[model samples]
Target: MTYCVGLLLDVGLVLLSDTRTNAGLDNIATYRKMYTFEEPGERVIAIMTAGSLSVTQTTLSRLQDAIDIPDGPSIMTVDTMLEVAEMVGAMLSDVSGKIAGRMGEQASAARASMILAGQRRGGEPRLFLIYPEGNFIEATSDTPFLQIGEHKYGKPILDRVVTPETTLEDAKKAVLLSMDSTLRSNLSVGMPLDLCVIPSGEQRISERVRIDAEDETFQAMSVAWSNALRRGFQEIEI
Candidate 1:
């Protein structure tokens, strides 16, 4: 399993995903879960996935193949972020159908889910949670975030700190702490995280990072957050 989270704030969007993928206890490995597509001033899109590697890899490959075909309705051709999401949902559902037919019902239900986020020229930024069925729902003012994979351990902080009014910088910190929470509680989701940030209206990814185990800044932030949590707990009267 893995953990991937996305924050949709008033100013921009922040996304983070772990690199770990595990087939069995001794078969653990790392692979990036974040994928980005950009045409600079024209559009920018990012996808973060969690679940069966076969399903996600195949789904992404099919989407890429469509994009490469002449006059294809790739994400780049969509007029709005909503349209982009619909195109992705349709492709994901199509690919998932093919894979499910081969694997049978129960196994296919374990496939995967994707978090899609980004913006296009003249359009507002959007965030979506693409379910295994290839249908999706957008993040709204009431719930400005979406998460997949080992999410139970990390959801508390997001519930407390994230909102439509949160700043992009704070959004980044929130996601990091959320990931930290998951890292502390789950063994399957391991290090070297991928993070992406897209500022509203930019039509480009403004920030992207790969945080390895030895990354000093992330280490320090994690340590500080732990300390803060401890202090907060200590202050609570039992």
Candidate 2:
């Protein structure tokens, strides 16, 4: 299992993902769940995945292969963000179907999903949650965020605090707190984490970072959040 989240704020896009993959309590490893494709001033794309590693990895590999082909219909070449979502959805579904077919009765274990966020030159940024069936739903003003994999543990803070108008700085805190919540409650979603920020109108990724388990800033933030939560809980009259 894993946890990945993306936010589409007026400023741009903010994405976060954990790097843990576990087959059992005794078998665990780390693998990055965030992938990016950028063409500097022309376009920028970020993909975050959660589910069966085989399915997600294969789908990403195929997407990269498509991009490598000269003048091919890849995420970078797609005319619109919608087309990119469609392309990713199709590739993910195709890869998942093939893998699941071979797995037979265990097909459900082979399912995976992705969150696609990007922008092209002269176009507005977009966010999508692509499911296992080649279909997706885009983020809208009413709900300016999308999350996958162990999402329930971290969704409350987003629901209460995030908005399309959120600043890039605050958005980063919101997502990190969201991940911190998930990490505390779920062992399957361990870190170090990957974080990316694409500023509005830049047509490029402005900030990309990795937050390791021992990062001091993240640790301090986590501690502060815990203390605040306890104080809030104590102040409430039940």
Per-model lDDT: 0.89, 0.96
- For model 2 the local lDDT of residue 78 reads 84
Off by over 4 Å in 2: none
Q: TM-score of the candidate numbered 2?
A: 0.98
Per-residue alpha-carbon lDDT of candidate 1 for residues 68-154, written as tens digits (9 for 90 to 100): 888978888868888888888887777777777887656655568999999888888899999888889999889999999999999
Best by TM-score: 2
Identify the candidate with maximal lDDT. Answer: 2
lDDT of 1 at 45: 93
lDDT per residue (tens digit) for residues 1-238 in model 2: 8999999999999999999998878899999999999999899999999999999999999999999999988999989999999999999999999999999899999999999999999999999999999899999999999999999999999999999999999999999999999999999999899999999888899999999999999999999999999999999997
